[model samples]
Target chain A: MAYNLWYWPGIQGRGEFVRLSMEAGGIEYRDCAREEGAHALIENMATFDRPPYAPPYLELDGHAIAQVANILLFLGDRDHLAPSNMNDRYWLHQVELTIADMVAEVHNVHHPVGSGAYYEDQKEEAARAAKQFREERMPKFLRHFEAAAKSNEGDWLIDHRWCYTDCSLFQLVEGLRYMFPKRMKTLEPDLPKLIGIHDAVAELPGIKAYLDSNRRLAFNEDGIFRHYPELDAA
Target chain B: MAYNLWYWPGIQGRGEFVRLSMEAGGIEYRDCAREEGAHALIENMATFDRPPYAPPYLELDGHAIAQVANILLFLGDRDHLAPSNMNDRYWLHQVELTIADMVAEVHNVHHPVGSGAYYEDQKEEAARAAKQFREERMPKFLRHFEAAAKSNEGDWLIDHRWCYTDCSLFQLVEGLRYMFPKRMKTLEPDLPKLIGIHDAVAELPGIKAYLDSNRRLAFNEDGIFRHYPELDAA
Candidate 1:
């Protein structure tokens, strides 16, 4: 069965989460919106069942699935992105959803006034958002990641088992490093366990291969998480 | 055993979504956060293998699950909140996640400046935020509902299945109507099937009783979705 992934082609956006999972699991899928063009992207959006309030939906068989975390869980379960043990599976999703929650906050650091507004227009608000995000949210998310690491009793979220939470944490650390280089540079030291998880995630065989290859999309301003110089503090 | 639902005590917020599912299913559970007091909510937040970034988590049989949609899906399947068929189950989650996306947007409407800021301070921004929400989001969401209605070969997203999607869609319409009355008044006429679904969900034995009961929290100014007079317009 061929899986069709539809997202704004230019930037990784939310599609990247599902992409990372599919790649890690070696699932074959097409980037539909990229192949079809922006017009097709908008047209497909109009056709979706709940109509994604935004981009990054996956089309399986004929049905389109939106919401990034939901897509990840769907693909994860299909290809073993989480633990099978009930508590472990539940914990894995909590951490993943928390990552999603953090991603939203990271996006808000530069887009506090609404996604429709440009960064330049909201820089003042973005500054305040970034400050709060950097000081409060970073530690909060990292603390959660650290707790999960401890709970797993080793490195990965499920001890010896690596799950989608790891891939997502890899993405979170990568995205945060891209968007807030100086901030992350200073903050990374405090969350040693989270950093260990992030570093370990990068070295995973499938992910290592994917990142080294052309499959990894470079973080750009066009995506949900973007780096703005004024918003980042050293 | 009994389910232990954890969430913030003061507001309907995200916790309400989990509560609705439990209530609709007629499942017995404790509002753990409420009974434990605000201090316990904070204490619980601090303790976890993977601590939730926010509340509205569920402790069922020693496993904790967070995220509004994930919680709904977990409960939906276990408690028959979803259909037994593979296709309908897939579609049901699609609808639930989409409702979650809409809920996120509704949250952005008020917190346009950022979650850290006081809404009073962001009223100017919230006005602009609410404008985009009313002009763009409400219709877009309504159209999605209309299509889902169209997809319903019979009534619900799946003809014979009254799943969590129906309950959530009912809540979305209800919340949207409460939060954006003037806009919904205009949009409702065009979304007949959605309204029908909303009415159908309202009449369900479980939901109908919940709506009339005191256990159902009233929508107030402090929730993720709110009704501010200045923020609403036709």
Candidate 2:
């Protein structure tokens, strides 16, 4: 059965994590918002009697699943993108949740004061927030992920097999590099394992094809990981 | 076997979500951080080879599970705090995840600029953030929850029985009321179903006793829902 994935059309926001996982797993799914228009997405979301809080919901067998990590959790279990064992699945989930946390932080770096406020209005606060995110949080999260990677004697984040966490991490690294080129440049050498996983995921047949295609949206200022030169430093 | 829960000592922070679930479910778990000192909590965390991103972790049968929603998902399934059917479980999980989203947003209202910076340092930004939260987000989330409640012909967020989502929603209402009394007072009249579930959850035998006991810590500035009069409106 093909999955109906609904997200905003233009930019790869949190939805990209789910998309990357599907693409990597070779799962059958349609980017509903992209194929249709943004208006169709909103109208479809409204049709759900108990609609999700936001976009990036997956509709399968007439059931709508929301939340990036929650969606990944379902897809991971279904597509075997998560570990076979339940215990390991939870561990992989922990990493996904952490990635979600970092994603939220990444968005805050641009709109620090509030999501309702314009980025220009909160530029000063964004700079302060971005500094903490880049200088302190980025390194800390990368180190935490690195530690998780090293704990297992494999290149993957967990076990020897690739999981959805790896795909999400690949996106996280790509987004971070685009948003904070200088900071990532300085930190890349120290985060060899994370960098390795990012590179490895990029090489996956499905992901490689998808990334090379127009299906993969380019990073832009409109997206979560927006590039603002002022927000990054070496 | 009893489970061990590790979280910060003071304030009903994120840990409260876990505590409320265990309480409502009548599950056996020790508040590790509360019984042991804060230093002990840190020392214990250091012992984990694959340490969690942060506390509010559950140590069960030598395996540690972190992330509030992840912990709740495990405990919900274990203690039957969640629905038995797989679809309802996912639906419950979706609501729980949405509640988690609001919790993150709630925390952001206080630390709008950055978690590293003091609230006092970013009071102006927080004031702007809190206004949007109190006026727009508070109503939006509550209305969305109310719709969820109305969708099912049940009082609980999911099935007729009390699920872990109810407990988290209870905490959300309690925290929001503490953080924004005037705002909640104005909005509560329009949110009967949410308030009804909040009241019903409190009436649960285990939860009632726990709230009365010292196990349920009081809300304070140190916690996610800090009551700053400036952040609220009538």
Cα lDDT tens digits, model 2, A1-234, are 889999999999989999999999999899998988999988888877667889899977767899999999998877888877878888889889999999998998898777877899889889888888888899889988887777777888887778999999999999999999999999989888888899999999999999999999999989999999999999
* Model 1 Cα lDDT, one tens digit per residue, B1-234: 668888877788878777776777888888887788888878876666566667788875545688887788788778887877766666677677677767887898887655666888778878877887788777877787788778767777676756777777888887888888898898888988888888887887888898898778889988887889888888
Model 2 misplaced stretches (Cα beyond 4 Å): none
- What DockQ results do all the predictions give, each relative to the true complex? 0.51, 0.75
Question: Native contacts retained per candidate?
Answer: 0.53, 0.67
For candidate 2, the lDDT comes to 0.88
Cα lDDT, model 2, residue A56 = 93
- lDDT for each residue of candidate 2 in B1-234, tens digit (9 for 90 to 100): 678999999978999999999988888888888888799888887776676888889986666799999999988887888877878877888888889889999999999877977899989989988888877888888899888777777778876788899999899999999999999999998888888899999999999999899777889999999999998998
Which one wins on DockQ?
Answer: 2
Q: Model 2: which residue pairs collide?
A: none
- Worst lDDT 10-window in candidate 2 chain A: A146-155
Query: Which candidate tops TM-score?
Result: 2
lDDT of 2 at B168: 92
